[model samples]
Target chain A: MKLMVSVKRVVDYNVRIQVKPDGSGVVTDGVKMSMNPFDEIAMEEALRIKEAGNAEEIIAVTIGEQKAQEQLRTALAMGADRAIHVEVDEDIQPLTAARVLKALADKEQPGMVLLGKQAIDDDQGQTGQMLAALWDRPQATFASKVDLDGQKAKVTREVDAGLETIEVDLPAVVTTDLRLNEPRYVKLPDIMKAKKKPIDTTSLADLGVEAAPGLKVTNTAPPPERQGGKKVESVDELVSELKNRGLI
Target chain B: MAKVLLIADHDGENLNPTTPKAVACAADFSPEALDVAVFVSGDNGVADQAAKLDGVSRVLRIDNPANEHCLAAMLAPQIVKMAADYTHVLVAGSTFGKDLMARVAALLGVLQVSDIMKVESDYVFQRPIYAGNAITTVEAPSDQVLCGTVRAASYQAAGEGNSASVEDISVDAELPDHTRFVSVETHKSDRPDLQTAPRVVSGGRGVGSGENFDIIYKLADKINAGVGASRAAVDAGYVPNDMQVGQTGKIIAPELYIAVGISGAIQHWAGIKDAGTIVAINKDEEAPIFEVADLGLVADLFDAVPELEQKLG
Candidate 1:
């Protein structure tokens, strides 16, 4: 069985994103970029499945500009056997991205697909489920724990109500949540080895998928800023303030 | 005339409060728009509650044992079949909604607008990004069927005076057989739900241990506030992950949010930024939580929490 892990390059989780002056988009120039934190967890899970003898190969796939190859290299260093980069210059929405992945999935014929539950950048959390729909496969999203038993995988999903454990047959899609696993640090030796791995580059035209974004961004702005309040000296002062504001 | 379909979120017994809030968002589009609520579950009682929601024109019930669990694969095809008559499909921005809508959008060959906070027009919407620091307005093409998830926290629930007519619908679409529900482990709490609670009292790692959370709980109990925890607290085994309030956790916009011993990381602040009045109780005055707090008290939570609880009582 083969595992195809989807990774995305996003603004580092620690950086405070600043919207462009003209409200076009967030300022990405000179800012730090890393593989999305959740995608890294997904890659780690794929590597674990491969090590446990459940999967024979791990292929990391990413869709973005040429610079996104950096994230694919990181995924390779994290233990993916190979990499696939779908080069696209413009912004691709979730549905189009899912279509492109579905095309590649058709070609690769992987037994399972893994992805992060949501990207920190767009926060859409749609691609994995959308891809599963396009491929007509089962989807177990927000998975905290995964156990592969023969042709079936038991996934523990983190839902709003609580944890739900579901069993999905093979050839399914799984999205990783935060508690899935701690991603291992990439070693210096592995980084050098990853550079030698093969990365196949393809264009959207090659996949026969058009970049049709269903939603358009009309405007962007900063959220209303909250003003800081004065510090109280004692519990009595706090009580008085609460009373004055009718908060208690 | 626009025809809108709302997918109801519910437990096996009752409907979740977020379902009515999503209906409120759909109602904002047009007063004359035909709003229909779809209850896809094995229980007919869920559909009975859906008929009582205000603003809906009717309730469509698709009762089947396979629809018992909210599996995205099993529900998306059924929804797509029913979606041909509707112009828009909307759901609450809960985990179940997000999961199901994404698949439905894909099957319809359209994109899903997620976590919509404001409905500027029938096609335009405002949504938060970068957690909550930035707001972006999005416009969907008018030609395609628009599908979206409404941010229930940002809207008021629709009134319950309406008695929409109920219609039984049979699903002929073949259900996906790959996914099967095994079991569920839910965190049952007697207090108000954190997302819908008017007031919330959250503890962080500074609260120390799981046992020490009693002080935080006592304060919450006194004010009839829901109990929440920071990701650090959840990671430290102080509380369940469902109680975590942060970017990766549940985003809440309560009337009043009290931060007890919380340092207020950016992720935590993202979830509480929409809160009306933020009160911070931490020994470290320099804690980032004070930056956005409506009232800051620089004191040990161990001392202040008990005193605050007593004073409120």
Candidate 2:
């Protein structure tokens, strides 16, 4: 069996994102970029699948600029056999990203496809499921545990209540949540070996998939600020303020 | 007139209270104006839920017990074929909405303009990214299936729409043949639904321990507010990560958000950015939570909480 993991290059989760002066998008201004944290977990899950002798091959694919190759390399350094880079201009939308992945997956046709439950950059949480729709396969999003028994696979997803289990045959999609697994760092030796690992790069045009211009993001702005309250010293003072605010 | 198919919420076998919410969005962008139809997938008893939504011209109740489809891929094709007579389709943006819209749109070779908070003259949508740090408004190109996910909290769930006996639409049983849902595990909480709770009392790193969360819970029950936690709080083991609200956690937009002992981090703030009125209690006046808070209380939460509890009593 083969394993497919989807990775993405995004702004580091720690940095405070600042919007451009023109209100177009976040200004990367001197900020470092890295693999999306959720994708790291997905890649970790794939590597685990490979380690358990369940997968004969591990492949990682990414949709972003050329810098994303570094992310694919990170996956290779960790434990992937090869990488595929879908080179695109800046500002790729969620649907476009899905189209690109679908086109690539159609050619690869791996038995199991895994990706992060949602990318922190967009948080759209649509691409994996959308790709499954295009591929006409079963999709289990926000998976916590994935069990494969021959051709049939059982996926446990994290929900508000607890966990929901679904069964899907092979050649299906399962997206990983935060609790799925802890991603490992590449050792210096593996990083050196990753430099020699083969990486395949392609474009949306190469896949012969014409992406319909859907969901054009106009502008992005931060939400309103949350204001704070007063420090009442005693119960009497608290009541007085509550009464004044008509919150009683 | 071209029909617009709307997926209404089905409560049990009936439509969900949010079905009208879906129809309102559908009617807004319906090509035929008011020529909208709704479909509820359940037993025959589910038809009344579809009939209750306002402005629904027709309703379709599909009952096929053997037609077991769980994932969006399975259900999308069903909705797509049902929507063949219609040019537009709308559903409230919930977990299922995200899946259904993405799948339905992909099957039709179109991508949905998703996470729409408000719908105006055109099918304008506002979606957040990088968590709530950024919001983007988008317009989708014209397609046979115009799809959008309406935020469950953004609209008033209207009721008392036109009553109708929906015709049973016969869908080929072969549509959703691929997927199987073996079982579901739900996170049972004694508290209110986190998203819909009007008054949400959240804790942060200041609380110190998971046992300290009981205080927040006590206050939540005292005021009937939902219990939420910052990623900092959840990460510190003060609460479950599921209760976290931020760029990495759930997005909460409530009427009154009472933040206690939380030294506001941007990640935590991003989650609660939509709260209408925010009241933060922290000893540090310099805490960022005060920057956006409606009321800033700089004091020891341990002392303040007991005082407030005493006053309420």
Reference-based TM-score of each model: 0.98, 0.90
Candidate 1's C-alpha runs over 4 A off are: B40-44
| Per-residue lDDT over B1-313 for candidate 2, one digit per residue giving the tens place of the 0 to 100 score | 3357766544345444445666666655544633333333355455666665566776665655543433565567777776667666777765556656777777777667666666654546777667667777776665455766776555655557578557677666346556776776556777877867777889888988988778888878887888999878877877777788776667777777888988888888877777777878888878888777776677788877666655674
lDDT, candidate 1, B1-313, per-residue tens: 5689889888877788899899999998884654555545565587778788888888888887778876778888889988888888999999889889999999999989999999888888999888877899999998889899999889988998988888888878988799999999988888999989999999999999999999999999999999999999999999988899999898998989999999999999988988989999999989999988999999999999899898985
User: Which sections of candidate 2 miss by over 4 Å?
Assistant: A222-248, B1-3, B9-24, B27-47, B66-70, B159-167
Q: Give the 10-residue window scoring lowest on summed lDDT in candidate 2 chain B.
A: B33-42
The Cα error of candidate 2 at residue B145, in Å, is 1.8
Least accurate stretch of 10 residues (summed lDDT) in model 1 chain B? B31-40
lDDT of each: 0.90, 0.73
What's the DockQ for every one of the candidates?
A: 0.84, 0.62
| Candidate 1 local lDDT, A1-248, one digit each (tens) | 99999999999999999999899989998999999999999999999999998999999999999999999999999999999999998778988889988998999998899999999998888999999999998899999999999999999999988999999998989999999999999999999999999999998999999876667887779888889888888888888888888888
lDDT of 2 by residue, A1-248 (tens): 88889998888998888877677778886789888888899889888887887888888999878788989989999889999998887667666777787777778878888988778877777788778887878888888788888887888877644576888887888888877887998899999999999999888888886655756667777665433445445546655765677665
Task: Estimate the Cα RMSD of every predicted model relative to the unseen true structure.
Answer: 1.3, 2.9
